[model samples]
Target: MDSIPKKLYHIHRFDSRSGLELYLSGKEDMVFGEDFLKFPMMNLHYVFSRGFICGNLLIDFSIGAFIHHLYSASNIFQDMIIMKFNEKCSMEVRRWHGDRTGAFSWTHTKTSVEELEGKSDETQDKELNLKASIKHIVTCNLEEENLAHPLVLPLADCVISAVLLDVISKDEEDYMRNLEKASNLLKIGGHLILFGLLNTTYMTAGADRFHMMKYDESFVRSALSKLGFVIDYCAVQRRRNVSDLVDYSHVIFIAAHKEK
Candidate 1:
């Protein structure tokens, strides 16, 4: 008899509201802050602060309702579009965007970004700007030929995703296909920024375990090169703390442009 593989539904039907409280309440979330939130937020601020990837429109396709990484982006892009694979995450973003009751608090993350930018007294204004700049929060299917499909959207100047492809894809080919699908949303010469977990097989959120597609920097570089993306900036941060929530060894951020 063969052993059975456990069912994992990490991102498929995630509870973004509770997930945020559990993993990223920030001030008291030392374990999660060190491994997951801090590095990505800091890196995103650093990347966007350099003014290398700014444009008219920006597309965000990150998993769950995680928008902590978008604080810096609010200053760069004039128009913003967020793509969600599931209704749960989609509604979660909308709830916060609409200022509805029971919305998750991102005040800590906002403060973190303000400190990183060395700015003060304008946090509320910045948050409002991000909210106003959001043109649409549309649904997307990464498996399709056109990521958004039916409702054709203008090609974005940049597409940024965080820790998504790893958990959503079943294999390398699946991952590559999704990459190509997402690439279709980006214009030629536009930039694509990706944040991924390296050498991780599984992750946990709100008592549910999810399967993650594991790959390394070399694999990602080869995939991007084959897809005609010119790799420009790549950074990998090794995990510095221990946690049972996710088993990722490092967080990798790559910035590239579509060459053709």
Candidate 2:
């Protein structure tokens, strides 16, 4: 008798609303306030606000990339391209960017970013800039030969991937392959920003669970070094809550420059 394969969740099973409500929004949730939220606001604040060369073209190979946090990038990069892994994610972003009614509310994220910046008046400006800077929100397949196949996307000056590989990759080999694909999308000496979940197997969303690849800081460092990326900054946030809402021991953020 043949063994039955375990059913694994993919982007097809992703619940964007539940994800927003559970993990990405609200300051009340410890998981959102301390771990996940802090990862971007802190890491990106350091990179974009500082004297880093944000360059003209930026690409984010992650779902819900600018939907929640990291709104500050719009002020730095000349143009941004968000490559969504699935149509549903793309549509949500389009709705938000287009200012369509009934779009998912991101007011909490906006407030968090404003609080971090120590200003409130520029929120509308930031939103407008973000909507204007994003030139495309095209569909992508990370496993494809060309991640944004048939689109002739530009080689980015900087690339961001947050919690994307751990969710999509089945193992270390797959992770490395995807990492190489990300690096390939950048120009030489370009920047690569990474956000990762540390030491976990599964995450829950509205009573449904999804598998995640378990990885550590050392693995991340080794892989980046092997790929000829010089680490500029790295920060890790250890788990602060033991709630069953999310399963992860830490959140890792990294900024690396592709040397070759």
Candidate 3:
């Protein structure tokens, strides 16, 4: 299996919120961060508009980092469950959901969602909807056979996993193991919304470095197919800005469904 050495990485020490801010709002950032914000949100909006059912149970395995996708997903699905691999990510999500002070504000994401929907004046309403839609936020181990151990969660209709596998899996085999775990949590014919970096090996959070499994578009399709998922929609965007934070060549998104 082709991969990077884990000895040089510190994935658990990653700051989820700060990373989101840097990727989404940093002026010096030339990366396709804006594309990240727009592409997924727009696709979700189109999915909703087409009367696509996101199902009653929506499991977000995104480690609760950036809420741009979550905020959009909230409106279409009820009983939303978010999971994180570590305590910091879980706590940060709880703070935001609980409306606690000093929560990392997602105002930019909110504004972007609203403007895209042509309902810029409906920010507060959307916030309320999001708050109400989230049923729980908990810690999860993506590497585990059961992501959330000791707490058995019902199979979900849709699972959103973004920017997670790349950083979590040390190799293609580990990536498939984690992906199978996520797939096991989904009901038959359930959808999997995946987002990640393509051909990227590493990322930075402050001074800490982390390993990301480098992979390309074909790998995504082949892996999902091997896992018995039919690729529904797939797209990729090239990076706009070169930054020291990461070395990803393209941003990839895939909408797939379990076929058997």
Best by TM-score: 1
Candidate 2 on 160-182: residue-level lDDT in tens? 88888887878898889889999
**Candidate 3, residues 1-260: lDDT per residue as tens digits?**
12533322223576766666667653444365556677778777766566554688898887436666866677678788888886777887788888899787766666677777888777768877887888888887554578789789999999988888787888899889888988988999889989888988777665556778888889878899999999877778887666767788888888888988
For each candidate in the order shown, give its overall lDDT on alpha carbons: 0.81, 0.77, 0.76
lDDT of 3 at 195: 85
Clashes of 2: 0
Cα RMSD (angstroms) for every candidate in the order listed: 2.3, 3.0, 2.8
Of candidate 1, the 10-residue stretch with the lowest lDDT total is 1-10
Model 3 — TM-score against the truth? 0.91
Regions of candidate 1 where Cα sits further than 4 Å from its true position: 1-12
Q: Supply the global lDDT for candidate 2.
A: 0.77
lDDT of 2 at 95: 87
What's the TM-score of each model vs. the native? 0.93, 0.92, 0.91
* lDDT minimum window of 10 residues, candidate 2: 1-10
